[model samples]
Target: MPLLRPRDGSAGDAQIPATSAAEVAEHTCAAEAVFHSGVWSGLDPRERAAALLRLADLMERDADHLAALECADAGKPLRECVENDVPGAIESVRWFAEAVDKLTGQSFPAGPGVLALTEREPYGVVAAILPWNYPLAMAAWKIAPALAVGNSLVLKPADTTPRSVLHVEKLALEAGIPTGVLRVLPGTGAEAGEALARDPRIGALSFTGSTRTGRRILTAAAETNLKRVSLEMGGKSPQIIFADALVYGEDLISQTIESAFLTAGQNCTAGSRILVHTDIAEEFTRRFVAAASALVLGDPEDLDTDIGPVIGGGAATRMLAAVEEARAAGARVLLGGTEVPVVEGGHYVAPTVLDRVPAEARILREELFGPIVTIQTFTDEAEAIALANDTPYGLAASVWSAQIDRAIRVSRAVRAGVVSVNSYSEGDLTSPFGGWGESGFGGVEKSLRAFEQWTREKAIWVSLHG
Candidate 1:
């Protein structure tokens, strides 16, 4: 067991077990056995839904504790963990649980004495490799749907932030989900994650992480069982601010700030690139810089804190280095781009805004995954659309324009999985969330569409004339 500390450098008592590849193999084998036993995978859909609902209740009951663990393990602001992540996770579970009975098969008329039908059945065993940024919430994204569809799941929480999800596994069992049905393996990506990816017993795998790692997982799958893989990877998402949108002023600025820096901008769909119409560029930049500078960066445990440290010292160093590199490449640093020593040993980078960042800058093309945003001016809608779609990644984008025609036009043109018009959002659970280009592959997460990733459709045919 290794002592895991919070990103805020606060003392943490959680002991994270470093699971080995052999352990991962054992767990996958156990999950497969349980999947075959019918204790879970063959149980009534309503029964599985009932157990999941109970699990949701237990999570809500222990919301405070869960939020605390999230704050500690992931260095998320206490307010964010309590108000957003924990609640969002609970809602995800509830939504999926309630949807269990509603997810139906199809019937088709084969004419005469022939019958034809299709049914969605769960893959015997599935694996979900979660990211550290939103441990609890992302876990629910995969876990709830997989369980609802009656699959035994092997969950591999990110090495840095395993506490919250490990706790979730306990609650799942207490809520009547069988022991082997929901197994949590907390370990590094190379060992346990790779083991899960390459194991033939894992019929399906869903991962949310960097693009590079997603490629590795795909390769592993290809070499082994050729298992079904669904990936939601990186993003250099753009937020285009057209002149007409400035009428919303304060509201626009506030929403854009959240889009850019939420979760310290480690979000996969973070709107890191801002493309403003040159007509209103100066005004928008001024307001954006002011609000970004005012964010309260401090210990994640404090309720008043608006920003917390990045995952660790290494993350802080990388973010700051990227900022300096951008400046050296001729970008103007409009606001805080320096490290904030909020506490001894805590990793904090001030909310940073860069103006007139060169198009060729690495910071513009790469996913920095920090509270740093870059701004560029586009003279027209076509240019804005071009700039928005320029990046190799396209998980999410935001189009701000009061003009309906312009908004609709740009939204359609921008290459992204999810686009927000006049505001910033990844949409609610009802909308399917994934990416385009390098940002995603295989399948999307959330809504009814998510169920498709965990299941296989079987078409049955029979003749009544016999």
Candidate 2:
């Protein structure tokens, strides 16, 4: 079959025009230098803010076109693109636009006879590598703040979803971002991604993707220029439900199924592990299976569709292999275990739920990264906490209980970075979002700490004159 190509002459493969590794490296390095030496990093806070606002406006105006391109590239629901992805991306730009002027450096009290102050300076050129899932939103997280702080960026979108990056670049250009300040290089990670990572001209790197790839990038950063690297990687997040939880009956069943199955469970923050009290495990599993079994799987463009295909063929095969391995290891397949019908000829997997998963199973230890959740039971709170933290991942988790104290206690006890009480994976622009352990390091935009990652604090001291 012929590969699908966008009107811009870019596709999953064959996107980059560079014919050699040296050419790719040279182009990426030149773009990074241009951005660092140009107006992007030199603009005043207000000017940078205005540029961001214009970018947001352009994103809003082109929401439909970009969303369609995103859906085509990612196989996600088109409605999700318009309702969630595009709006979220635009809001990120707007938030950072307004936040630039408000973001200020700190001054410390100097000892007698000396004056001291600290100022945040942009980290020169930044390389932002975005994943396929939620491409625009991830890009916005890196782009908005990096630009707002007056740093130029070089972006590389995932191999399967480069069109959205091009679309975003075009929007930024339309929004008056000066040329060479923001450039999109669409190619394989081995080529364009590594080139950007190893380039000495790029001062910092922000990545959102799998842990294996993140580790590789980190190694590259260390071996090459030792640049500042911020990574948001994989997760096998847990959603614990206590006996006294408010979501006991119908709500528990519904929320658990939806949270795990959203985006076909491709979300890094998806509630893949359901920890239920021993007394309620069977009941929870039954309801969860029923709800998940009923989800409508079809064309992503269909407004009524509840689920869509996995991002690509390799992902779908991996998900299916996990399911088969779990079943082979004596786990019960309570819901789906195969693909469903789709309008487009692409990869799709049904929402699946595996019950009685053992600790030793690969599905339990590793991120399934698909619409598959494993249910486990514990007799006590300590056991529940132990079960939740068993995996190497510590990205996000949730605790459900009617008693606020129980929820609070469990929320604090969980090893993940972001934990919710009585809810699942609700992140906003005002809050910080990142991971712990193997999930990766450094939070992205919205968090006050995120700004620090993009900047280097320079302390200035002056001796008092006699």
Candidate 3:
């Protein structure tokens, strides 16, 4: 049996159960039938909203159990999964639930004796392909709004991180969500994910993972139904540092490294690159490296551990090899860049900081999705902006500056989807979360805009003369 393992590298007794093509076909067919029945959508919008709220209530009630499942399954730090992911996901469910009824439509006078009103309706079925890093939270990010707007959903979680989503899907059903209304298929992306993506009955598709996988999903959709697709993919985001923000050297160090190292740097929004002004480069680099090296890496079950392990041995080997390749190319290694053997069974990578990294270094340009960060120096504002925008990704970035005008200008000029000034943020529930370029084709996940992705618009026309 192919078992799902914890960060300690110990596989749980649970096997990687195979889900069949027939099963996927059956699930899609059922989801379509649910949409047509309109049992969910026909409910006064408030009832749909209430269903979501009930799900949120169940989430809170089961918070401790869910948090433990996420920690053991995905190798995430237990504290963060509980403090952030679980609660944050519950809040998202509630937020979209509240906003569902308030999303009004448009009406206009067309021509003589004609009137037109526009309505936004659910797309029937949506496929959400979630990544392993933030399993439970990412699932909530997609399904909360998708369900609130009355669309039936099919969730395909990463093979390595299926337990949490599967656990929650049961909670959702117990909260009165109809069985066909939400289906969780636990299997590999190669089989189940592709099946879901190519299924013509799936009204829309949403994915959060690597750029390579995102491209494959896009191709699959085009070759099949060409269903509406929304992707939140990979990022090699940069954090730009200015001289003025260094007035409190500790503040800059604290915020930037925290963003980079969270989830042991397995986040798509990880600020993997730090572009600093030539003037402040020395001080900023010093403080940043110091904080990174001090991070506690141990068994995630221990709350005192700052970070757990990467997903498994393969991730640790790949992340470390990238660092060695950079070192061989003459980049200066400041800290970390190796694995921590002290943490038993789970894969533990030492948080690494490198400077003078050649532009050609694979670690500098690609998303390592581990606790690795690279530093570079820029001579002026123009150079900083140019270097920051040089990558194919435009997912997220952070800018630190005391000058409000400079901060505002840089924030506007950067090509990223989300930019934070002076602080590091995963972004807010009220705003749209998405990216551009190879980071994604452009789709927002949260807030009012996300409702648009799961639902389609229709025009109602009437002839007053009749």
- The top-ranked prediction according to TM-score is 1
lDDT string, candidate 1, 1-466, tens digits:
5433334455455556688889899888889899999998888999999999999999999999999989887888999999999999999999999988888889898898988999999999999999999999999999999999999999998888888888899999899999899999888888889999999999999999999999999999999999999999999999999888899979999999999999989898889999998899889999999899899998889999999888888888888898899899999999889887895767888899998787888999899899999999999988998899888998999999899999999999999999999888998989999988899878878899899999999999988976
Best by lDDT: 1
For model 1, name the residue pairs that clash: none
Candidate 2 per-residue C-alpha lDDT over 303-372 given as tens digits, one digit per residue, 9 for 90 to 100: 7777878876777888889889989989999888887666556677888888876668999988878998
Error of 1 at 24 (Å): 0.8
- Please give, for residues 107-154, the per-residue lDDT of candidate 3 as tens digits: 996878988999998888888999999999899988888988888999
State the displacement of the C-alpha of residue 114, model 1, in Å, after optimal TM-score superposition.
2.0
Off by over 4 Å in 2: 1-20, 36-38, 246-250
Q: What are the RMSD figures for all models against the true structure?
A: 1.3, 2.8, 1.6
Which residue pairs overlap in candidate 3's backbone? Answer: 7-346, 8-345, 8-346
For model 1, where is the 10-residue window of minimal lDDT?
2-11
Q: Rank order by TM-score, top first?
A: 1, 3, 2
Output the lDDT of residue 296, model 1: 94
